[model samples]
Target: MPFYDIYSEDVRCGRGASKSGEETKTAEVFAGDEVGFVVGRSAMEPLEPHLIYHNGPGQVYLSQSTAADVREYEGDGNWFKISYHGPTNDSWWSTRDQTGMNFTIPDSTPPGQYLLRVEHLYVRYPIGTTQFYIACAQINVRPPRNGTVGAKTPSPEYMVRFPGGLAVPEYMYEWPNTRLTEYKPPGPALWTG
Candidate 1:
């Protein structure tokens, strides 16, 4: 496997960014908060630009076996509803540095621990190729509540679980050598109920 690096940080959650394996949390806020992620990369060689998709919604409905079955879905478009904020090209260096991406959890987004899967791909030449995985960060989106500067806001009791667990898979496509490499991120640091 070639050396590919993936790094991410939560903008809403104030924390100095670090390589994958570092654990972080978001600031306690209302249920419907617009959260963003600052994702960057460093690799031995320039990598081809790939698509980043949030498979959260699909995970909410699919079963564990079904979720892991990437073949069941047809391309990134089928697996996730993607929204790009960066350059859309086939160049590998597009994501080589710090790139900012934002995702707003619906006001109706249940308050609980959510798994945000980040998938990288080079989708201009041979369909889906060039892949990498980033460490999953825990986001604790609090619920609405009344306050008088010190009143405690009760946390909602909603549970959000990723269909195939939180361990993201890492695979790569080296043209002639196409192989699926299992990449495991750091373990879950904290648990929410």
Candidate 2:
């Protein structure tokens, strides 16, 4: 659950380089646009046969807050929503194997300042241990050119607490187990908005 700001640093530091700090850079995205991140050293392999939708060098989420200033955002309200990839699991892959990953910005998402959060979850390595590599990128969400905002709205169903979201199963953290066909992603359900 240790959080960083970006992934453009030394690999020796591992995912620690993305941790949030005093300084940060902002990436801009329109309400409806495709955004992707280059597979940097921050990527990690999953412990189990991860579903493509949940697998990642890390999961990318969007929030209006920087995630540090809790005074402005608190409780479930501070939560960030997963950026929609698509209907299929085509975007899923081992962060270690892929060059990058992409997702579409929903037109319904509110336009404002946001923090693009990237998280890399590792369930192996120590065998039965779980580690997380999280990074946040500052972003500004602009309205679509037509000026018509999406009808859909963000709701509680799309929110989940960071440190407490993933409740790992013994099969997921331990190696050599059954291959699960269905998987509920660690956090709350995907917010279409």
Candidate 2 has which clashing residue pairs, if any?
4-18, 4-19, 4-20, 5-18, 5-19, 5-20, 58-119
In order, what lDDT does every prediction score?
A: 0.30, 0.51
Error of 1 at 129 (Å): 2.5
The C-alpha local distance difference test score for the whole of candidate 2 amounts to 0.51
lDDT string, candidate 1, 1-193, tens digits: 1112222232111122222213434345444445555544446434654234321111111001122322232111111222232222322223333344555544443344433444333322232322333333434444534321222222322222222223322322232222222222222211111
TM-score of each: 0.36, 0.63
Model 2 spans > 4 angstroms off: 1-22, 42-58, 66-77, 84-96, 124-128, 173-177
Error of 1 at 77 (Å): 20
* TM-score of candidate 2 relative to the true fold: 0.63
Question: Tens-digit lDDT track for model 2 on 151-174?
Answer: 355677676554453444455444
Highest-lDDT candidate: 2
Off by over 4 Å in 1: 1-29, 43-98, 133-135, 144-193
**How well does candidate 1 match the true structure, expressed as C-alpha RMSD?**
14.0
